[model samples]
Target: MRVFRILAVAFAAITSLSAAPASAQFFLKPADLSGPRVTGNEPGILGQTLTGATQTELDAALVWNLRAALNVAALQCRFAPSLFTREYYNSMLEDHAEELAKAYKTLGGYFERTSENKKQGVTAFDQYGTRLYSGFSTVGGQLSFCQVASDIGKEVLFSPRGSIDRIAHERMYELRRSLLAWGDQAYRGYFALAIPRLPNFNDDCWDESEYRAKRCGDFFASNDSKSG
Candidate 1:
């Protein structure tokens, strides 16, 4: 009977352990910065043109912005070996190649239509790409940006084909918000160190080689003695 009871207890302990969730490095979920929903037509959200862009062109801009953010995260977030930023990004390139290519082509067309000539358009398009990647660069918020990008990248893998624009329109603001620096929010209690007091180092308290006991009172004097 005792043996059976012990076995039951052991099984219960094992079951409890197995049921508990595994812990990883914890970070608070960032505030919802993706403001009121829109129809993927807001060019201003991703730093694109404030005018002249049609709905399709705006959607393309959002998609390109998201791609740039993730690309930057993949390059900057490699310090955290566990993050799948690079792998997920590479997979995204393959899985959504058609949609991404379409967005890039649409953006190129917009620049060409707005520029004075083909050469100027090409130059403007190249500058836009450069600025897009540069916009996501971060030093202080690198961890937050990388973690957020990884989460978004994983979601993109499961997203429906040709719906990358929808993901961008929904999460691009949140991604931008993550670029602002934030730190641990939990309040850890203050700890005051009790540093040991040292004896006086005055010349009178020390002989050439050793402490002068007569001048220093005690080598390790009491606080009260020193005060007196």
Candidate 2:
């Protein structure tokens, strides 16, 4: 009887361990900033009138592209600084140069497309549709800054532009200079805090899925349950 009980306990433990969900892993993945790797021989100009895209559209597009590029630069800083470096941190500097180049290309493409569409009297929604898109980019930038600051105990220099593209460009320039002066550790620290943490699955009294499914309610209730 003693032997059977011991065997049953061992089996139960093994089964419980096997049923456990995998622990969450965190790491910053690099982003692609290379000029839209997909382009073709589209006509250089649309009808003689020029494209129908407006100045507002062009500005919005620029902001969209710049933010995208900045995000890519941040990822590059995380995963592949060696790819950016020429020697020591020079390669990282080069990576920033390449990121800026891509940003410019994307901006130019936006302008060209806008002009072409405007000439043909066709609306370019891609540009105009990006009016409020800067919010996400701003959040990403803030998270990136926080991650770097938390990790390296250094400040991330950012621009004060309301427009996404200009902010991205200015931020990149500032980040590049800061990186050169402070080294990669600071940026790595930023990533550590910027990335979200997973819930503790081992706590049986609290159901992670229930909390995730619930919408906004009493803040104190949510905090108490989460704490428990």
Q: What overall lDDT goes with each candidate model? A: 0.72, 0.34
- lDDT per residue for candidate 2 within 87-144, as digits (tens), equals 2122223324544455445545555565556533223434433432332233334434
RMSD (Å) per prediction = 18.6, 22.2
The C-alpha TM-scores of every prediction are 0.67, 0.22
Candidate no. 1 TM-score: 0.67
Instruction: List candidate 2 segments past 4 Å from native.
Output: 1-50, 80-157, 161-228
